[model samples]
Structure formats: C-alpha cells, structure tokens
Target: QVYVNGELIGGCDITLEMFERGELQPLVEAAVKVQEGNQQA
Candidate 1:
C-alpha cells in the first residue's frame, strides 16, 4: 500500500496509474510543500 501524510493513496496499481497519468510527482511535491509549511509554523 502507498500512503502520504498518513492518508492511504492506494496499492501498487493505483499508484502506477497515477504515475502514468503524470500525477504522482505533483502530488508528492504538494505533500512535501504542505509538510514544510507545517514545520515552519
């Protein structure tokens, strides 16, 4: 299973689908940005 920020993203197939659709990177980037913002707060 894949997770981000304690939220379940999905299993391998769903993650692969998102990668194929060019979504995963942006999602990860957004998640990282949010985490960084939280850290700075």
Candidate 2:
C-alpha cells in the first residue's frame, strides 16, 4: 500500500497501474505541495 502523511492513499495493485500511466506523479507533486505548505505554516 501507498501512504502519504500516514494516511493510506492506495494499494500496490492500483498504484502500479497509476505509475505505468504516469498518474502517480500528480499525487506525488500534490503531496510535496502539502508538505511544503505545512512547513511554511
């Protein structure tokens, strides 16, 4: 499973498919944005 900030985002089966379709990049980018926002806050 994939976890972001200790929250489950998806499972390996779906995540792998997303990775193949290049869909996971956006999720990772959003996670980074959220982390940066939290740090700034």
Candidate 3:
C-alpha cells in the first residue's frame, strides 16, 4: 500500500506507474516540502 498526505495512492503497481510517468519524484518532493513547513510552524 501507498499513501500521500494521508490519502490512498494504491499498491506497488500503481506506485510503479506513477514512477514510470515521472510523477513520483515531484509528488514526494511536494510532500516533503509540506512536511518541512509544518515542522517549521
């Protein structure tokens, strides 16, 4: 299973699909950025 921002993203196949389309990195980066900002606050 996979999740982002507490939302479901699905399992390994779906995750691989996102990675293949080059969406995973930016999604992870944005999630990290939000987490960082939340920590700062």
Candidate 4:
C-alpha cells in the first residue's frame, strides 16, 4: 500500500496505474495543496 503523510492513498496496483496514465502529478499537487491549507488553518 502507499501512504502519504500517514494517510493511505492507495495500493501499489492503483498507484502504478496512475503513474502509467500520467495522472500522478495532479494528484500529488492536489495533496500538497491540501497539506498547505491545513497548515494555514
């Protein structure tokens, strides 16, 4: 499984699929935005 900042994002299978489709970057960027928002809160 894959965890980002202790939250489970997905398992290896889904992660690999996202990478292959070039969708991982947006997901990562969104996650970063969420983290930044939380920090400002």
Candidate 5:
C-alpha cells in the first residue's frame, strides 16, 4: 500500500509487468528504501 500526507493515495498488486521490463523491480526497491529511510528518521 502507498499513502501521502496521511491519506491513502494509491497502490498496485502483483502483476505480469514485474516479469517483463523489470522496471517495477527498481521502483519497488527504491520505494522501500525511501520508506525505510523515512521511518528511521
């Protein structure tokens, strides 16, 4: 799930695209990294 400013903004579930371009991979990874960084702060 994803949210912004305490409001649920949008999200996505497992899909076929993750296996195609591999673009989703980096995005998911980067998003997690940023979220972890935010929580740590």
Candidate 6:
C-alpha cells in the first residue's frame, strides 16, 4: 500500500515476509513523490 500523511494513495497485495524485510526505500521514494505532488498542488 501507498500512503501520504495518513491518506491511502495506492494498494497492493504482498507477502508479510517481504514487508518485514524492511525493503521500503522504493516505497518511501514513491511516497516522497506523492508528497511533492501534493505540495505543488
């Protein structure tokens, strides 16, 4: 799932293991992009 400031942005299904692995940099980057978009608007 994607989120911005507690709002849901996008959603997907994934394994709990993958989520627990802490592989969140890409997701964080995406969230940053969303935040930037919101800021620009």
> In lDDT terms, which candidate is top?
1
Enumerate residue pairs that collide in model 4: none
**Whole-model Cα lDDT of every candidate shown, in order:** 0.93, 0.86, 0.91, 0.83, 0.59, 0.62
Which of the predicted structures, 3 or 5, would earn the higher TM-score when compared with the native?
3
Better of 4 and 6 by TM-score: 4
Q: How accurate is candidate 3 locally (lDDT)?
A: 0.91
lDDT of 3 by residue, 1-41 (tens): 99987778889999999999998889989899999999999
**Highest TM-score model number:** 3
Winner on lDDT (2 vs 4): 2
Error of 5 at 35 (Å): 0.3
Q: TM-score per candidate, in order?
A: 0.85, 0.73, 0.90, 0.65, 0.54, 0.47
Residue pairs whose backbone atoms clash in candidate 3:
none
- Report model 2's TM-score to 2 decimal places: 0.73
Q: How many residue pairs clash in each candidate?
A: 0, 0, 0, 0, 0, 0
Please identify model 1 stretches exceeding 4 Å from their true place.
Answer: none
What count of clashes does model 1 give?
0
Overlapping backbone residue pairs in candidate 4 total 0
lDDT of 6 by residue, 1-41 (tens): 76555755455544344356665556667788988999999
Model 3 C-alpha RMSD vs. true structure (Å) is 0.7
Give the Cα-based TM-score of candidate 1 against the true structure: 0.85
Q: Provide the global lDDT of candidate 1 against the true structure.
A: 0.93
lDDT of 4 at 8: 77
